[model samples]
Target: MSRARSDPDRKLRKAKGRTASSARWLERQLNDPYVKQAKADGYRSRAAYKLIELDERFGVLKRASRVVDLGIAPGGWSQVVRKLRPKAAIVGIDLLETEPIEGVTIFQMDFMADEAPAALSQALDGDPDLVLSDMAANTVGHKQTDHLRTMGLVEAAAWFAIETLAPGGAFVAKVLAGGTDADLLGLLKKHFRAVKHAKPPASRKGSSEWYVVAQDFKGRE
Candidate 1:
């Protein structure tokens, strides 16, 4: 494994009235080995390692011809795709602005919009072999509300994958720790030959995020 971040010896000077949560987050970012590795590897965010780790276990990127990325801000996932599958037709959409990634078609549009699916499909020029979503809703501090909101994004992403993925394609999305809800799990099971959950080592141990991988699409009826 690559070297761990510098011993956590560096300290941030206390700022006036900084919240404990913010301070802890800052410290974690500074000391995270993945953050340092990402910088060395020229990845835009540490989240890149999460994708790398997942791909290692799940073989999500190999031989993909057309791919769609939802919630692609910071564009690390797209970067991984570009490097691993250089010839793959790649399109990504996000609500926030993402700087241009060479060879990736990006739209600064909401993936939840009615026109988003059609736009993505038209851009790719063919059914996607891999549909990826890393979207999570903004938290409002209430656990139930937060879960519901994020899961809603997951559900929407699942529907898009079901409708757009080519036969024998795959869908992968970020989900919370309890894994996908019953209804969503049922939908994926009906369409894919394998459905599994994975939590990569790059994910923080305390983080509730887990990923659901649905593979071998059965094609639309």
Candidate 2:
């Protein structure tokens, strides 16, 4: 096992103070137990624990289920899905390239474009059991603009989920915390039996991002 797997907290503390910004980030990592545990568990990113926590709370993943992962660069979320359901077919798509991961098919494409969802559906070969979007727009230093941009991606992902989700499928996407998501939540409530928002432990404490999980697709459209 790697040293990070054995002494994650020590590694985080040692990583502190290399640079002004890095010092603060390291302090946060050291204080976050999830980050330490993720290092010890050999996961690629701390984001993996968010998926694990969400699944534990929602009972989302299942053996042999088909799962779609959006914005899956760096492969952490995909790694979690693969570990949880070894028999499941997993497909991941992102604008940036991702290194090959065992048992995952990755497509480098901008999913916000019109043609992306069709390409993703073609790759899946059938409807997916679960669709997960951990996508966020690159921060432009304007809070309102950033929120709108992120919401656009979330809405697009939700629309694609409506198109390709299996009858009883589930969709989960990241959203900003403020009241900006009310309209989108209303739309989701119409199509899903239950919809709830969650802030997983692995996420940064100061981040505006939260996840909206919509379960039991009703196929309204």
Candidate 3:
């Protein structure tokens, strides 16, 4: 068994200049099994496991040849894609700078920018077989406002997938606890053959995060 699989729980001592919240977060990271596993497995972030689990359950990566990864900072999801689909052509965009990955084209630009869509489409050079989005708007602490903000990004990602995905393509994106809202859900159902909501095991139990997987794009009719 891997060391990560056998490691015992750990705690961190409080440090100077650390806020209570920061200290708690550090302690949680210290004890998170997924964090240990990510270090052991050479993944940049624990989030890679989330994509792994989702793909295992949904088979999202099986047929993917060209992939678009939105909000690809730290490049964990892209790393997962490259590992699972070594021959896939991947293009990713994010507001934050991301370290280069072996098989991915990274663009450090805001996905909300007008030129972003054209840039990604051009880079892929073909309609993507899979579009993955792990975007969330920065929170302002108000629950309702935060939900709406993140949903806006999710909506944008869904529309991008619908517009640029090949027939039978798949879209997977992160959504909050309530899942996709009514209007967005309706849009996904209209464009895809199947739509489902999932909370992967890698996500924290206290987290509001969930995933919306839409598969079998019906073509632009």
Q: What is the TM-score of each candidate against the true structure?
A: 0.96, 0.87, 0.96
Backbone clashes in each candidate structure, one number apiece? 0, 0, 0
lDDT of 1: 0.93
lDDT of 2 by residue, 134-217 (tens): 999998999889888999999998988888898889998888876337788888888899998899866777887799989999
- The global C-alpha lDDT for each of the candidates, from Candidate 1 onward, is 0.93, 0.83, 0.94
Error at 125, model 2, angstroms: 1.1
List candidate 2 stretches off by more than 4 Å.
Answer: 1-19
The lDDT of model 2 is 0.83
- Residue 184 alpha-carbon offset, candidate 1, angstroms: 0.6
Model 3 off-target regions past 4 Å?
Answer: 1-9
Q: Alpha-carbon error at 73 in model 1, in Å?
A: 0.2
Error of 1 at 63 (Å): 1.7
Give the Cα error of residue 159 in candidate 2, in Å.
Answer: 0.5
lDDT of 3 by residue, 1-221 (tens): 13355334556776899999999887888878888889888999999999999999999999999999999999999999999999999999999989999989999999999999999999999999999999999999999999999999999999999999999999999999989999999999999999999999999999999999999999998
- Tell me how far the alpha carbon of residue 52 in candidate 1 is from the true structure, in angstroms, after superposition: 0.9
TM-score, structure 1 vs. true: 0.96
For lDDT, candidate 2 versus 3, the one ahead is: 3
Off by over 4 Å in 1: 1-3
